[model samples]
Target chain A: MKSTEILNSLQVSLTIKRLCHQLIENHHNFSKSVLIGLQPNGIFLANRLKSNLEISIQDEVQTGSLDITFFRDDFRRKEKPLIPSVTNIDFSIENKKVILVDDVFFTGRTVRSALDAIMTFGRPLSVEFLTLIERRFVQNIPIKADYIGKSIDTIKEEKVSVLWKETNGKDQILLYSPT
Target chain B: MKELSTSHLLGIKDLTKNDIQIIFSTADSFKEVINRPIKKVPTLRDVTIANLFFENSTRTKLSFELAQKRLSADIINFSASSSSLNKGETLVDTANNILSMKVDMLIMRHPHSGAASFLANKTKTVIINAGDGTHEHPTQALLDTFSIREKLGSIKEKKVVLIGDIKHSRVALSNIFALQKLGAEVMVCGPTTLIPKYMSELGVKISHNIEKALKWCDVANMLRIQLERQQIQYFPSLREYTHQFQLNKTLLDKVDKPITILHPGPINRGVEITSEIADSEHSIILNQVENGVAVRMAIIYLLAGSINRV
Candidate 1:
């Protein structure tokens, strides 16, 4: 199977900037809110959003990265389960609204596991989901994104990989089918 | 699907049969790597690992650092004395700062129990607890098992005697769990105060007489007695304990069967074990130290795989 070229001429940085503006406008009154990025690419996107949010709010917004490897439901199947990256949230999350940011949303298992991992720290007033891309598929749980940059229809065999210059040396989304 | 990658190695008691097998098999692969001339691999190449040592250590810290280096991973050593953590910088802040550098794993040895787990919660790095107060030293136990398996073939139904300061030794606590899981009959012998009464409930027999325990065991593991832990006066005198509990050549004669001697160093020399027994042909004490690197390399390789995939 050949991978489809859905993002052949896409401008990811522009889309991300526009998404940051939308998120800031949506929660302009939040004072102590934080942005928690899920591991790997989500963390990269979250850090980028955090810098942009900090400039717009003119205040220091707490930014953290979370790794959900141990909390995953399918951990038993991975041959070489990578050690999770660092999850760093220095401040308290109790009674404060949080935006759970990620690069892409698929079956929502990662998000579900992220919630389980987050609850171990403290209870939050509410958690809003934000993603750069959302796949058109049935989620295991009734979870929806509060802010989405783009929505793409994909099949089970298809994969959406997000590459950025900060880590991957490029900014593009690839739709690949395993050969 | 590897079960070892998904769970925190906080204690050996929680390990299943499969978990033990995975560690053993992984260590076997690492042993081969140790024998190679190059003695290095790209398994963890480009990954960042941090060593958070809140307590001063020579053996454990160096073994872990060497293990990470041999696996081709970048390592950052954080000594508590020099770290901002000494100036009341919170553990969270230290972790956050290291996280910003994108560390893939954190190997920690703190003076408090559950300190590694606390750091695990704060960071995405896989936490390998080196030693937390007197709580547990999982890697030491794992390497001991590796040493035993190399010598004895199998630990199933083997009589393993653990002699020394049972109450204050983290190595003793971790060995009990590892040995029991591998099907060894573990017995701990020491002064009355040092040997907890309810230890049999943890599947270990407590004996005050080393002579009795020696007669019935295939393997004898001796633990170092920390002078600091004696402030509470657990024993009447160190001299008395040494005379009765120390495993010298004369004590080795009590065992009729072929016996192996093990210890987590630096040995007390004349306290828990004598120079004769420590350097004896039956001693695997040095083997335990050599195996520590291989065992730690296995851990870092398995855990760092997650980060490289990113």
Candidate 2:
């Protein structure tokens, strides 16, 4: 595998800080705006954003974890049963400005599925999306993101990995292409 | 990454520990889905299911129907009493007629053992055994075990006793297979005549004493006497049976440690278990019913996950 480092540890931290300030600038105090992390990867970014918001805004911020396994269009189309992560959204999203966060944006199908899955809890006033790495020119579905840290163009065979300190030893984003 | 080992869910014996875990984890997700305000999903939107009931059922039938509807699958219900089975049509003929209508899957409940297996052999569609006579009620067993795990966390190293008529119960048979496979120590306590002779070979403890069984178990899964399936009297009378084996509050209170209680429903009140015990916090009977829908959804979802549309 030929890997290209998209963002290193220090670069990743700076990008997250920028994203946190961007969120604070738009939704001041985050009283009406709720941050929701997509399950598995997005929660890590969501939590970091939440903690950063709490530190800067000097108040608690509400964030929830959402899983979209059941709402996926490829339910019966898969070779094996799709495993699901935990979905724990206790507070109602009704009329709240929902900021959906994810690790990387590739096909945009996950965003579409997340949009549908969030509707089950309550009707949000509006849904905005944020992602760490937004791959360019590879979207299979039409989805627009409100916040993006970095964007890149890659071949279909290449895979993008956003490693977190929780699972990985350090934080970094890399694109792996076939040699 | 785990898939069901077999295409058709004929019996618990046909499933491996990995398969059971797969179903349980899938059911865990469905549990979250059902708890939400909008409980339905569009996973099986394109598939059609035929619920064929060759026997009488209220709980199992409704549970399966609710599960299919939650997954957004189309269904056509058939009760054998109202169908052409009364007009001398065979079971195969009835199933074939349904399958010929382009039914994508079949959920069946029949009065004969191996009816689900027979249908699986004859049909190309996936068959989920919703209680075949004296054989297996795989989903019920799954939900029962699921309730135990939900209430008590894990089934491993736990003492689970199945209390009731074992000879005529498909639920008991399926539960035995499921509980044993999950590493729980199983004990079947009932009348000697009601206990099957082959249970000893299965390695579960057999006890004729319900009180002693209660003391020995961490979980008590009380089963109904199944009076309808009882062709001959296993015990002298209902009074005698109740006297010997009824799980009332007194029997429950006698246990030194906290014990989880489970009953697969259509529960015979005051017979196998008293109303007090059934309504107590220790009992997860209603949880078993609610989990029935979620667990069946998981079973159907996993079984139908890989089917290629024709």
Candidate 3:
């Protein structure tokens, strides 16, 4: 596969700082809002944003990790079994604004699943989407992100990957294509 | 740990230690999901599962149904009493008729041993043996071991005594197979008629004395006397059986250290176990019921997953 480093480590940090600032500009103290990180991949970006947001807002924002494995529309289409991760949201989301976070915004399927999943907790006052990379011109659902880190045009076969320091010992986003 | 090699979960004998570990961890995640405000997952929304019970059951059937619902799968429940089995239709015919509707999986409970295995071979759909005669209730055993591991933290080197009717109790048979495979020492304590001699060949010790068994073991898994499956009286009377093997607070106090108690309900209160012990802190009966849903979900999810991996 051929790959290009779209965002260097330093640029990634700056983009995250800017995203945190933009999040604070709208949500303020975030006392009425909670952040939910989509499981498996979104968790890395969610954790980084959650920790960074706390530093900017100077208050604790209830952050949780949710696994949409069971909620996916195509969950059982393939024979390969999907291993479900733990959905750890100990607090109630009733009447609070929820920000569903993920790494890449491609088909909008994960966000769709997250939307159905969040209802089990309680009815939220409102729900919003936040994604790190909004890959341009690819959406199977009528869904868009409220917070986006970067938008880039890409082909159908190309893959966008976000690496974090906590999990992969680096902070970068790469776009990979078939050689 | 290795994933289960077989797509169908007919019995504990088909699972390895690693398979149990994988199921336990998967159930652990499910347990977390059930505790959340939103108890449902969309994973099995595209799949349809049928719970086919040819035998009478309350807990297992409900548990499997609840697990299926939680996974957001389409569910159909069939029982012998409500179905056309009274018209003399064979089990295979009934199953194939249901499968013709495009059901993706079948969970069954029957009065004969290997009944699930028999159907598994006849159908391409995934078959899970909820309980099959005196053979093995794999899910119950999985939940039992899961409950034990959850309570005591581990089963390795732990002494578990299966008390009461062992001959006809499918739970006891499955538990023995699963626990032993996971490195736990197992013993059967009951009357001579109830505790078969061939059980010793399976590598489990036999004990007729309940007091000795309780004192020696770290966990006592009390089993009900299945009077329904008995053709003749296995024991003389219930009073005599209770006198010999009943577990109350007095028997529990006799042990030097506190031992965890497990009973796959509906409990024969005051017979195999007294009300005092069944409701005590040492008993994980309710926990077992709660884990039942999670374990069933794991089994269904994993089996469904195996189909695609192939």
Instruction: Choose the strongest candidate by DockQ.
Output: 2
DockQ (Cα-based) per candidate?
A: 0.06, 0.69, 0.50
Instruction: Candidate 1: list runs displaced more than 4 Å.
Output: A1-179, B1-5
| Full ranking by DockQ | 2, 3, 1
- Residue pairs in candidate 2 whose N, alpha carbon or C atoms collide under 3 angstroms: none
Write one digit per residue (lDDT tens) for candidate 1, span B1-310: 4546345666676677677777777677566556544466555666788899998899999999999887778999999988787578888788878878888778889888778778777766678899988888889999998899999998899999888888888888889989988889999998888887668789788788999999988999989887775668877888988888989888777665678999888888988888988898899998998899988887776655554353
For candidate 3, please provide the TM-score of chain A on its own. 0.96
Candidate 3 deviant stretches above 4 angstroms: B1-3, B306-310
Interface RMSD of every candidate? 14.7, 1.9, 3.4
Local accuracy of candidate 3 as per-residue lDDT tens digits, B52-143: 99998999999999999998889999989988999999999999999999898999999999999999988878999989999999999999
The alpha-carbon RMSD values of the candidates against the true structure, listed in the order shown, are 19.0, 1.3, 2.1
Compute each candidate's TM-score over C-alphas. Answer: 0.64, 0.98, 0.94
lDDT of 2 by residue, A93-178 (tens): 99999999999999999999999999999899999999999988999998978999998888889999999998898999999999
Model 3 reaches what TM-score against the true structure? 0.94
What lDDT does model 1 reach?
A: 0.80
Lowest lDDT sum, 10 consecutive residues, model 3 chain B, at B301-310
- Residue A96 accuracy (lDDT) in model 2: 96
TM-score of chain B in each prediction: 0.96, 0.98, 0.98
lDDT of 3: 0.89
Give the number of the best model, judged by TM-score.
2
